[model samples]
Each structure stands twice: as C-alpha cells, then as structure tokens.
Target: MTARWKDLCLDADDPAALGAFWAAVIGLEVDPDASPSTPGPVSLVGPTDGHRVWVNPTTTPRRVKHRLHLDVDAGSVAEVEALGARVVLPAEESGFGWTVMADPEGGEFCVFVRDEPPAYRLHGVVVDCRDPFAQAAWWGRVLGVEPVHHADEGYATLEGAGPDDRLTLDFVPVPEAKVTPNRVHWDLVGDRDELVLLGATHRWDTPGWTVLADPEGNEFCVFAA
Candidate 1:
C-alpha cells in the first residue's frame, strides 16, 4: 500500500467559503468531484500530490484549543506569506531557525529550514468529540490503529502502525454541538464499494468518490478504482 500525508481534516462553519480560501492559499483544486445538490459536504482540496486538506462542515464553534493541528516547514517565510498566511509572530533567530504563522483559517503552522527530501508528511492530526473513548474506538476500527497512550482523562492518542510513517491521532473532548458542514476529510484505500455498507454516504452525483462520516460526523471519502 502506497501512503503519504494524503489528507487533513479542517472543521469549518461555512464549508464553501473556507474551502475557497484554502484553495487560493495552497493552490489546490476545489470540489474536484463535488456536485450541486448535496454540495459535496466534504471538500478535499490541497496540493494534489504531497498533501490534501479536507474542509468539513462544523457545527460547534471554536472556543478552545484545537484537538487536531498541523506543523508545516516551508523553504522560506516569504513564500508562505505570499501564499496568504499572516505572521502571528515575527520570525526569530534561534539556535535552530524556524518561523511560525497561522493559515487563513486561523490554524497555526511552522516553517523551518531543513534539507530532507519533502514529499508528503502528516505532522499530526487531532480528533475532538463529546465522547473521546467512543470516537477513538470508531477510528481505530476503520484505520487499524489503537490507542497507544492517554494525554489526559479527556484525551488519547493512536500511534502510527508503521516504522517509516510518523502519524499520531490525538483525541480531545469537546462540549459544543456540531452545526456546520465539514470542509476537509480523509480518503481510505480499502475496498471502496464495501465501505458504503459500513455507513458511508455518497455525495452529490459523483461515481469515482463516495463521502463517509464517523458516528461523530467527521467526514472521509472512499476513492473508487
């Protein structure tokens, strides 16, 4: 199975607006397979090869820390700024040089100078819900990863299933209700049509892709061959 940083989930109130903003910032194609009636509901937009960010319609308002987040290392601060990222704090010279900034959606990420070959890397993903245990369990069942450690009584993490891939799923607790659509989502690689029997919902009138969500409403897709 060939895998890299394929997707990131972004909770948003207005899926369309947020998706458009990210498309401009990251130069990604929007609604690559979405339709008019259902509105895709799940937007998979980002760099085609390296990374793809999904915008999910979120009902709960963001008031506390993000359960999931990302840390990106760019070649230069100028390049990211030109892409519409605002510098929350100016770049400071440290023993190791790195600059931090926030995306258009108010998500914080970093830009560091490194010589490693940059293909596709998923820094990390945070999963938040009212019921942490259940949500974690559901994801584990779908992805084949289990809880490796607990961050607190309200949070836990699922470690990567491989030696080469550095992936961690952070599950956090939330008190608010989900109100809007999900702008970002994931794409599973197993049997596409079978997932439909697993509560996966088809979006719009598309045939190549099918949108599915967790019990908590976190969305993902199954790409057909």
Candidate 2:
C-alpha cells in the first residue's frame, strides 16, 4: 500500500496556541486526545470535510515569506482583521483574483473573494519553488496525485482525489532558494524509508512521523500508515 496526504502541518513554537488560533479560524476543535504538553504536533479536525490541520511544535522561526501556504475564504475584510489576519496583497494590487493575507503567526494564506460559498473555508495550497515542474511531479508521486498538470514554466497544479473534498496543490516558480525549514508543510501517511527512496531526504524525526526534505529542501512529514 502507498501513503496519502493526511494533514497540513504548521511549525510553531507553541503548538496549543497556534492550534487554538486555527481551531477558531476554521471552527474546528483541538483533538480532545491531544496532550497539551506533548511537545509535538497537535491535530485539529472538524467542523467536517477536507484534510485535517496539525499545528506542529518547532524551534525554527519563520524568517521570510512562506514557500507553502493555505488559501481560505475567511469572511469579509473586517471579519478577517478581527480574527487577527492582516492583508499582504490587496485584491487591487495583484492580477490574481485572490487577496493575500497572513495569519496571526504570519503564515501566508490567501482569501479568495468569490461569489460562490466558500468550500470548507480552506480552498487551495500554494507552493513556491525554483522549478515548478519538478516539485509538482515529485509531490504528485509522493501523494498519489496522478497525471499531474503542468502549466507553463511559471506555474503548475494538480487537483486532489475527490472534487470538493480537499484543497488543490499549486506550484509556482520563485527566484530565491529555500534555505530554512518551511513554516508550512504537508503531513502524509507513508513509510519514511520508502519516501527516502522516492527522493526525500530525512531531516529530523518525531514520534509516529519522520520529517523529510524534498528534492529542493522543502520540508514535509510522513506518518506511519
């Protein structure tokens, strides 16, 4: 059997505090089973449908713009600001149809202003890399995303299994190289050794999961299945 995408992991110093922030943002509760003093990832599931969110404890701090980020449809600008999200890119500033914003912890996420109702609040996941094609293909294989879609040199994307069940993945090119642990990352269920064979470099490890760096040094994790 192969592994599957499990949750979107955010590395933060305070797992419970960060977890609580997202819990309120998404209307999900912290998993009751999560130990407050575990000193690791605390999983949050809820208000239903889509991948779970995990706030992972880390000593690394965010130093620059995030290479990977979530896109949400958090209410109006007032509501978003009230919830501690601030604008990074106003809709009028970018050609894209989404507004770039950052969470309380400064994790970059976009708020897509759409007429249709928001899809479980979370919409898309964006990754920045030096080569969109290679990164997209690598993650596609690791996550079982078949026939990955290759856009132009600037962009690439692939949809997940169920139509509306999970957020889509988008890979876009950036000039700078990733030199530190990514603040945002994917959490999956798979074998660490197998993943290493699949081109992931083992970085650090924690109980039930192994932190790995992708071909480009982007960090992610594999949980035992």
TM-score of 1: 0.55
lDDT of each: 0.57, 0.76
lDDT digits (tens) for residues 1-225 of candidate 2 = 346776677888788777877776655678878636667778888654345787878887789898888777755656777777788889888888788888888888887765654536666778898988888788778767753655644677777632245568888889998877788877777899988998889999887678888899988778787
Q: Which candidate is the best by TM-score?
A: 2
User: Which regions in candidate 1 have their CA more than 4 angstroms from the true location?
Assistant: 1-69, 73-83, 87-101, 105-121, 151-153, 161-164, 192-205
Q: RMSD, model 2, all Cα superposed?
A: 2.7
lDDT of 2 at 137: 81
On a 0 to 100 scale, what is the lDDT of residue 209 in model 2?
Answer: 75
Writing each residue's lDDT as its tens digit, candidate 1 over 68-112 gives: 455454556776687768776655744335565677666665555
